[model samples]
Each structure stands twice: as structure tokens, then as C-alpha cells.
Target: MFSFLDKFSSPVKAMLILTFFGIIGSALVAVSYTVTKAQIAANERAVLTHHLAVLVPDNLHDNDLLSDSLQVTDAQALGIAEPVTVYRARYQGLPVAIILNVVAPDGYSGKIYLLVAIAYDGTLLGVRVVSHQETPGLGDGIEERHSNWILSFAGKSLINPLENDWKVKRDGGVFDQFSGATITPRAVVKAVHHALQYYWEQRERLFL
Candidate 1:
């Protein structure tokens, strides 16, 4: 008994129309998310793999470093405000090394983020400064290509460097500091030492 326009003008009919569209919109959003979720995860994994390879090297690890990641929350030990990710690398089902995400909070201008790779036997694989706000020419030498400064830490461990000799050259340690930049190197050295201390403490749980 109702006209088409009359039905549309009814409150119940209007409400029904709105509800129908809302359900359709929500279904579309769900479908879109389902379709894109795997790709997003893959992209993130690829990035993490590349970083792990840079610090630990591809041939050295047979297991998936991205899948073997753990989060540790020790602000004082890591020098960061938030938890840091640790990537474990293994060879032939045995632990080879671990890459620790570290932050040097006392850099010359600001914080310096680093990736430190250390073998299970306590050998230093490498130290990479991922991000820093240090001086362009001087403090930036902490970067591998900037100079051999970063490479100097490659073979060093707590035993090799000796705990008391972990400071910059100006502080009478074995590592060098840029001519005009001591604070940056000092902060990095301290952070590396702290990372070594942490690994020594958590080696058992970490390898498990």
C-alpha cells in the first residue's frame, strides 16, 4: 500500500538503507586488509633481513634472524628509553652471533643508534652506527665509510680490549677519536662496552 518514494521517506526505511551501506563498507575494509596484510609483513621481513645481513653477514647465519628476534627492556643497560630488539644468528643449529640494537644516549649532539654484532664465543663481528646526530665531518667518522674508525671495533671483545681500556684515545684507551670530536667516540665506546656486558649476562637465556 506504500509508494516507492513513500517507503524511502519512512524512518525505518532510511535507517535500513544506512545500515546496509555501513555493513558493505566494513566488509570492503576487511577484505582490503586481508589482501594487503601478507605483503606488508613480507616488506618488513625483507628490511629486517637486510639489516641482519649487514651486521652479522648472510653466510654466517643459517637460521632466520628476523624470526629469532627478542625484545629486551633494560633502559640503563641499553641506554634507550624503550625496549631494544636483539637478533640471533645461528649456523648449523648452533648459535653463531647476536646483533644487539643499542643507543648511545650521550653523543656529542644527541643519541646515536647502533647495531652491535658479537659472536657466541665473545668475538666482535662488527659495530654499525645506524643513526646519529653527530658532527658531519668529525663525529660522523664513526660510520664505516667515513673512516676505518668503525672497523677498529670489529675484532674487539671485553677480553681483547680489556674492561678498563674501553674509553676513547683521549681518555687513554685504544680507540681513536676524531680530531675535533671526542664526545661522540666516548659515547659509542661506552655503549659498546655496555652491550658486551649485557651479552655476557644474558648469553644463556639469549642462546636458548
Candidate 2:
């Protein structure tokens, strides 16, 4: 008749206990990671779907934007360290629009992230400020809820305003800058311009 620890010495019993618990802990961690990973991915998809819908109209695309996506690793142009994901919207087997995730590395306070929607013909459908840390009431005008300044970017493109006219009013551009917040708008304008440049360079691959 063997007791729980009868086959092992005192030291061996302690080692066995630790090993048992170690295995249990590792398994728990693996299980937790698997479940949490799936949840995180689902939440991310839902958020992307919402952003795409806001930028590209519902009737414009027939396929799933979340599934129809590609990644671009750009730092100097995009102002981001990680790979940027470009979501494509297709209509009736043809490319309709491409929504880009871009960052303005020179915002007043910090980076001003954006989701820019561009049509197949190089026209801007919409622009949404994803995140920013600019001063309240002043730099916040870039946000749609704060003011309509953001809407001014709609129907715009590289040639629409002319490349040189992409700057803020303070710098002699077509767009207006906030009374006391020039840096924020300036940064956003430059960023939007860069996004267009990127789309132009990758238009062939993007449409494919």
C-alpha cells in the first residue's frame, strides 16, 4: 500500500509538488492567452468595421472590409513604427475605395492618428481623426465633433488643392488654422497629404 508521498523522499516530494504546480500554471496561462487572444481579435475587427463604415458609405462596398485588407510597413512616410493596415472596399468585383491608417508625427501635443478614405479616382471621401493629445478647445477643432474643420478635407486630393496649397492658412494654404492652434492643423494637413502620396505610389498593388 503506497501513501500519497510514500514513493518519494522529503526532497523529492517537494520537487514533485513544485513540478505539478508549474505545469498547472503554464497550462492556465496558455489557456488564458488563447481565449484572450480570440476576444482581442474580435474586438479589433468590430472597431475596424465601425471606422470603415464611417469613412466609406455602406452602399459603396459589397465585400467585407475587415477581411479584405493588406499591410504596409512604413515609417518615414506614415510616421508610425509598426506596420500599417490598409483596408480595401470593393463594389461588384471592382475596387471602390481604400481606407488608410496614418499617423501625424508632428502634432501639437503628440501624434495625430487618422483614417483616410480615398476613392479609386484619387478623391477623398472622408477623413476621421482616430486619436490625439492636443490642447482642448483649440487643437480639438480637428475632431469632427468639436468643429467642421475636419470635413473640409472631403472631396480633396493631391491636385484638387494643388500640392503647395496643402498647408494651413497660417502657412498660406487653402485650409484654415485654428485661431490659437496652428500646429495641430498643420500636422494633420501634412499627414493627409502624405497619405495621398502613399496611396498614389501603391495604387496598382492596392487595387489588385
In model 1, the Cα lDDT at residue 176 comes to 84
| Winner by TM-score | 2
Give per-residue CA lDDT, model 2, range 45-73, as digits (tens).
Answer: 77667878989978998998878999988
Model 2, position 69: C-alpha lDDT score: 90
TM-score of 2: 0.79
Each model's C-alpha lDDT?
0.87, 0.90
Runs in model 2 deviating more than 4 A are 1-45
Candidate 1: RMSD to truth: 5.3
Query: How high is each candidate's TM-score?
Result: 0.77, 0.79
Backbone clash pairs for candidate 2 read none
Displacement of residue 89 (Cα, Å) in model 1 is 0.6
> lDDT (0-100) at residue 130 of candidate 1?
78
